[model samples]
Target: MNTRIAALAALFLAAPALAEAPAMTVMPSPGCGCCHAWADLARAEGYDVSIRETDVAALKDDLGITPGHRSCHTALVGGYVLEGHVPFDAVARLLAAQPAIAGLAVPGMPSGSPGMGDDPDARYDVIAFGGTAGAGEVFHEAGR
Candidate 1:
């Protein structure tokens, strides 16, 4: 009985570490400062982020990210794609829900969006795209 209790305690203690977020691979365009900033923000949020500099245009094309859904950087995490300066909350929701979509996008670099700038009143939309018919839909709205 004491051995079983010890094992249970060990499992409980290790649960939190096991629940840590999966590692993320971020592909950013060469010479893009904002992309690096965004990766830093993601790291601050406790995500294991790895940055890989590459030709973003070709990468976007290969990933099926349409022009309208393009962003300066792209990330792959938990089998989902993230484009641009996507907020941490939105990414959290996507991971939790595990929606049947190709990924999420923030489109252009909004003023207050993550890695863009600190504008309290900036507003932007995170778009979910490439599910069934490959249409884009509003996934989340950020800022004021």
Candidate 2:
């Protein structure tokens, strides 16, 4: 009985520590204000942000990222493409929920988004992309 209890306690303790945070490689054009702002936001949210200054257009093409999924930059997060100016909270939710999708995107720059920082109340959809590189679903709708 003591051994059984010890085993259970070990499992419980190791479970959370084993769930490491996903690493994000952010590729963006140099001197892009909004993109920088977006990366900063993600960093503030405790993401392991890696900024790679590169040709934005080429980076998108190389990663199979298209205009419909485009934003100010591109990010590879947890073995998935995180395109555009996505909110950090949304990214956190995706990693936690572990949904059936290829990637997450916030197409185009919205006014009130973290990167843009204009429309604090602007509405936008956090879209999930499927494995086939197509649109998935509205993962989250934002007003904040």
State each model's CA lDDT, in order. Answer: 0.77, 0.68
- Which candidate number would show the highest TM-score if scored against the true structure? 1
- In candidate 1, position 30 carries an lDDT of 82
lDDT of 1 by residue, 1-144 (tens): 123323422422332322475677788888889999999988888887777766779777767789999989988776677899999899999888877787889998888888989464678999987765334878888873
lDDT at position 63, candidate 2: 56
Off by over 4 Å in 1: 1-18, 133-135
Tens digit of per-residue lDDT, candidate 2, span 9-110: 242233232245445667776778888788888777776666776677865665556678788887766555678877777787877766656578899888
Error (Å) of candidate 1 at residue 73 is 0.6
Clashing pairs in 2: 111-119, 112-119
Could you tell me every candidate's TM-score relative to the true structure?
0.82, 0.75
Which window of 10 residues has the lowest lDDT sum in candidate 2?
Answer: 9-18
